[model samples]
Target: MPDETTDTTAVAEQRIAALAAAHPWVSEARLTPDGVLLVTPHPRATAALPTPGPLVGEHLAHWEEVYEWTYETAEGRHAGDLDLSGWRASDTGEPLPTAHMRDWVDRTVGLVLAQGPNRLLELGCGTGLLAHRLAPRLEGYVGTDVAAVAVDRLSGAGLPRAAFVRAAAHETETPPVRQAMEQVFGAGVRPDCVLLNSVTQCFPDLAYLSAFLHSALTVVEDGGTVIVGDIRHAGLLEDHFGRVERARDPEAADADIAARVASAVAEDRELSFAPAAVQRILAAHSRTVRMSVHARTMAYDSELTRYRYDLVLHVGPAPGTAAVSETRQLPWPGRGSEPLAVLLRKALSAGPVVLHGIPNALLTDAPDAVTPHDLRQALTGTDAAVLLDAGDPRMLAVAAPADRATAATARSLRAPVGRLAHEPLPAFVQRRLPEVLRDHLRRTQPGTVLPRIVVDDAPKGAVR
Candidate 1:
């Protein structure tokens, strides 16, 4: 077998030579984009140059560094010789031929096709996995990346259905690439769908990610969809399992194991987002936004790996619309919000209710507020009850002392009034609001009933 260092040096030399041949302007190459050192006639003159838009030049600089690292240099060895293969294999996995990432790419492509594809642009199109999978189903496909090597590789692979462009994430705002998009697709050639799968999380900052999103919106047609599949946050996994296993010691271990696997896969990088935050950012560009998580686990090298990606589907206005109106509304549950909550309460009444917004805080004001204990008491006796927030008068009816005996005594006081104290306000309101009003109408008028509740004006200072 060839010595690892010798093999790596040969590979690096070839890569450096290739990069130099392609981009003659590059002077000194670093390992990453941030480390790229461009040689100019005057160092001060280069510093005085106008700031480039987004991070185009920065991305190019990183590409140069990656190129240099691939070369056999006397100073330092390239980690890519080991890191790239390891990362690629870890991402795609062995025996799969492609990386484990292909599974996610396939899933995302299926989603895009289901949405109805006219044209599509995939940002950070690493290896063109998505574009290749989706090209056959779409009218046109374009994939762009910061690395010229990726573009050349995809092109050489004969992905004739899709065109590969060497453009950085920040360069979409500039000419050339933007102009090429306009000329190829015509004036209003916004892609019907834009796929950002496991891509945005790679960005070091939210500003870069937001800028990419903003630029993407310009080429995305109204009523188009943006599909984002990436890890958002790691703490969410801890919170999720911690709450689920609080009661049983045996079950807690399983939760702990799962959390560890999730943390390992994510590597503590903040990639996941609360559903509400996803909604807020997407809402500005689309009329209706929907998000769902497809959770799965894989075993590799005797280690369990957990994969969960938040899939956001942003829908623009239908073909004919006078205007696209944006509104702040409750996030719609994957199924139905109200029904899901009601069923959960009925099945697991004692369990702590965990609420998370679609992205951040788009669904409800108190995204993480646990159901109050008073409401839980009200829910025990009756099939359901009206749920109210902290300020509602109904809340006053259930507020009791924290002691078990005191709470029991308070429950006794409300029993004669046909009210119970254990039900959650949100859960009760979700389940019984309609039925309660309907029954009230039957008693008020024997034969006819009003379609919806009608509240008479309350006197000034009267509690609702």
Candidate 2:
């Protein structure tokens, strides 16, 4: 008789190849001698994948369909889904070190209860993990998610005081929130606590967060606490990545990071947010907000991990109260107006520069923190310019349009640099401009064109 393991491998490989061939998105597939089958999705087809069910609106592009499909297809084996072991696995992000998640969860439960909430609403509560851990302790509890599977499976599985619903955070007045409110206070009362735990990433932008907040406030009683927990902040991304890189030996760090990336790819999930932007939006909207750094946002971790923030939004505080952490935008020139101007001014301050470095520097502190306004700011001012050789648009990440910056709107930047003068450059500029502005003066030879910045090139005798 043939061995069971050998037969299983042969069957698995055949299924993999067959599936790859059948899927319209699968661009290529190949099997290695070791029985490992590799499959690649067509780039465009993969990008166009949308949510499975009817959405609130077609306009909610990124959040509406992107998350719907992502969560629905997520396998139980993926980190943060149903994999308790993977929750503290090595080579991933965690609040404390992987070993300390038990303590973290316990502490989080304690902190949440400390708010003295009688009836609570939990948004984005994955797999009812917290409910399993704390439902018996609560008077009444409710959970919600965008994934229908999670809702259908756990809707009635919780304690007598608990229930689950399929709902999207960005949707206006979701049924879950209404049902949750009813469960807690019959038909006439609001929830004492509305917990948005590890759910901010599901939102596409700050506007959606603001919308969600408004909706939550409408259904929440006065003095009710809206807890935004387990926020994966990008402000400390570099610092955290640096630490994770240092924990393992050099080779191990590289391999570990590679493994982490592979896992993210497999799950079709990616989550990142800039703490600064989050603070700014919250400050402009909520009067009182308290941020606590705790809990593992990413689920997995290396030996050491850092960089997730838990925030409490005190909807309506008592007589004398203020935000625990009040954030304000910097008073930098051209501050709120345009991003292109700000980017150029900052980049040129460092002398001759590259357009890519400006946005990259801005992101060093917070991923996706640079908004449309910031990108517009960089292109609004003409203080200086960057030089670079034009190549494939893909090579210049900015040229490819996405949700962040509208690259097509900045088409003027693609013009030959020599003909371009003091007109406001786009958020990004690329030409082989020399290190110094004087590089242009040297290119006086016939048919020789060079790109360079013009820092007050007006005849010195003509103006001050």
Candidate 3:
């Protein structure tokens, strides 16, 4: 293989060409003078979903490509002052406000500092976003990533009490990482806090996350905290897609929007988890650790504030570190129930309120769910219909009856939309609307910040 470190124009074009081939949606790919490979997708590719959104595989091969490309772009564009945070605005594909990104960094720094850790370990450090901010404050810091570029760059940065390693998340206990950690902290010592921030979404699945956590908890100090930050919320998966679809085309018909949303959700390669899912996974280690969920406090109404959250795993049973308890419970509004605005106002006055099953507002007005009959009607003149009759495996699973499915089939039948061939549609009304509504409430109700924080004790019984 050619040297991965240096990329000539031809090499860059070849790499992008291969990536584009894997992604049929890509219409144009070009390398900028600065070495960033910019890809432009076909206009209708999202609705069409000709192929999966991005490449995903073991050890986050896809993310490695992305970060390598991103690092080059940031290095060229920003030069001496590099913002390695990777927080970008979607509309323009530029980095979001620096202050907003720093707000999150500051908050995370405070959380890790509050633990008073002598040593800190960050998995998927991604060019030292947190390492640069935290390395000076701690006695020892070890940052790891799959990207050699990041590790090599950070290694030369000469940050005090910091070591950079090229390792995957699950490789925490491996020889390379262990040697690096030993050099920083000392022999036989573990980090007081292990952080994986804005990185879990790149994880392949829940199994990968679980495996990483198992390794993380084992390597951290007994009373240390494992902070997992900027997690994409699984419960808001649909809402996230819906927002994207609407933003892509504000005037798109509901049917078109619905179709594209389904396609985007299906093709999404990033891993997301409901707070409950993460909590359940943490349960296995509950006997020793307490789990707490926190919402991003970023002032902007972007993806981070809208769909992402944070988790802090307090390792070992410390005397005063009990789980957060909900002080009140409130039912969300229905057709006949009190207005959502009013209910939220009431809930705000009540401290630490737990809102139950809030319906997703975006889907509230979405097209009806797809039934077999609806599918048969919608697919009447389409190629998908012929495939369905021929029992194409992709067409077999029609959306509608399944709670998670929507009119994915119907949407595809009408347009170039390709999302319906696999997954089915759920009820138009669903409990997936909390995060968006939270944003709405924030805008409509001044001084009303609903805490999306989730606090729960570890499962009833779990081993380390």
Candidate 4:
């Protein structure tokens, strides 16, 4: 008898090809000999790909629809598992290293615990990644999200002392924070710590973030903590896209990379903030709130470590509460003069260091741009910590738009080899491919363009 599996696969491929042929977005779909399916977009459809600029009133709805589809389609798989929460992968569909994810969680939880909060309220707690890990240690935990499916699933988990509610990041009044407060803590109580981990990027703009911060401060008890973690650095936006473009086509000319980076920057929809911007917003809200920015201590030097940092605000803290050891300010020796590895190594050995106003390496045609990997290697076996902070806002210059048109958005198609035959191409693409693409790109692209900071480090374990 002929193999049944081969016959089934052939049928599935035929059906998939037919579906792709009918889909307006797809020009062609074919299975490789290795069973990977490749779908090319229709040439005319490329122009119509969404040009997402500043998302004004519709950002909340956009994210809700995005995550609702995420949890709804990923229901059957063990998507609820802590490890799978905010799952990441490369453009080629290979999962990125999980060590960095673990580092982020561990460090964030450490920051929360350091706050010594009795009860914790996390905004945008998609899949309860932190809540699940944090609930047992806290007196109470409340997780909020825009996706009802995420809320429902996390609610069903029965995690002790933890409650899941459906609410947008900017809207704390809805679903009534007081109601959750009564259920989690005692009546007429409030959580001491409010966390928005990996949540700020989804915000439509700084205005939305400021509003959320203001609302969060009103509910959080005096002297409480508000942790804004995984904030995209506005300064390194272009350098970030430059790195991605370089990786995509290593042999591409500098002009091509610059053009692509400009196009990507223009279309980016995520909200990135300068540390200075955060400082300004919080200062405007209340001077009593002390804030400090810290760099990621993850061992790996991926986009997260390179282009993102965390902000911790101490609500109503005493004066000098946020003070750190005097940081030795070092003017960044431009990229062409001294190797960054040498500069950083010397700086850390002397004491805690901070370098301001560095030029962006990707902006110039310097091929030997010192990467985070080089900085990490320089710091190996030392007590010092190293990180790149956002640079002066004036140094960043915008590139002219790319002449070539590219897809405005990537459709996420989820299919296990031949299994997508029954699913519509548009649905599958929206359901599968774009989520990964967004997550991957979200870290790499800044929502806004700002200056670039080359190196910022603190010694004696101050930053770590």
Q: Summarize candidate 3's per-residue lDDT along 271-317 as a digit string, tens digits.
A: 66654454456677634766545444444457776566566777766
Report the C-alpha lDDT of model 2 over 146-190, residue by residue, as the tens digit: 666557656656465777777766442666567665775577666
Put down candidate 1 lDDT per residue, 1-464, tens digits, no spaces. 87998786556544433333233222232223332222211121112123322222333354445543432231221222111221232323432323343444454565467567777777667655566667667677777776666666666766544676777665665675665556545665667777776555444333344455656666667767666655443324443333323433355567576766555433433233333334345556534433333221222221112223334354543333222121111211332345435643543343222211222221124433322222333344533221211111111111111111112112222222211111111122222333433454356445642333221211111000
The sequence of per-residue lDDT tens digits that candidate 4 reaches over residues 1-464 is 98998897677656544554445544565656655445554443322112212213334567678778876776333435553434553223444566677676776776578568889889998877788789899999988998898899888988888888888776676656568868988887888999998877776555556677887887888988788898876666777778878888999999999999988765566667665565556667753676545555566657676666776777874434223334444554555566665665554454444443333342334453444334445555554333333233222111001100000000001111111011012222333333332343334443522121111110000000
**lDDT for each candidate structure:** 0.40, 0.44, 0.56, 0.57
Off by over 4 Å in 1: 1-102, 237-272, 283-307, 318-464
Off by over 4 Å in 3: 1-59, 75-81, 321-464
Scanning candidate 2 in windows of ten residues, the lowest lDDT window is 420-429
Which structure is stronger by TM-score: 2 or 3? 3
lDDT value, candidate 4, whole model: 0.57
Task: Give the runs in model 4 whose Cα sits over 4 Å from its true position.
Answer: 1-55, 75-80, 83-86, 89-93, 319-464
Tell me the alpha-carbon RMSD of every candidate: 26.3, 22.3, 21.4, 18.1
Best by lDDT: 4
Compute the lDDT of residue 359 as modeled in candidate 4.
Answer: 39
TM-scores of all models? Answer: 0.44, 0.46, 0.59, 0.61
Mark the 10 consecutive residues where model 3 has the least summed lDDT: 421-430
Ranking of all candidate structures by their TM-score, best first: 4, 3, 2, 1
lDDT assessment of candidate 3? 0.56
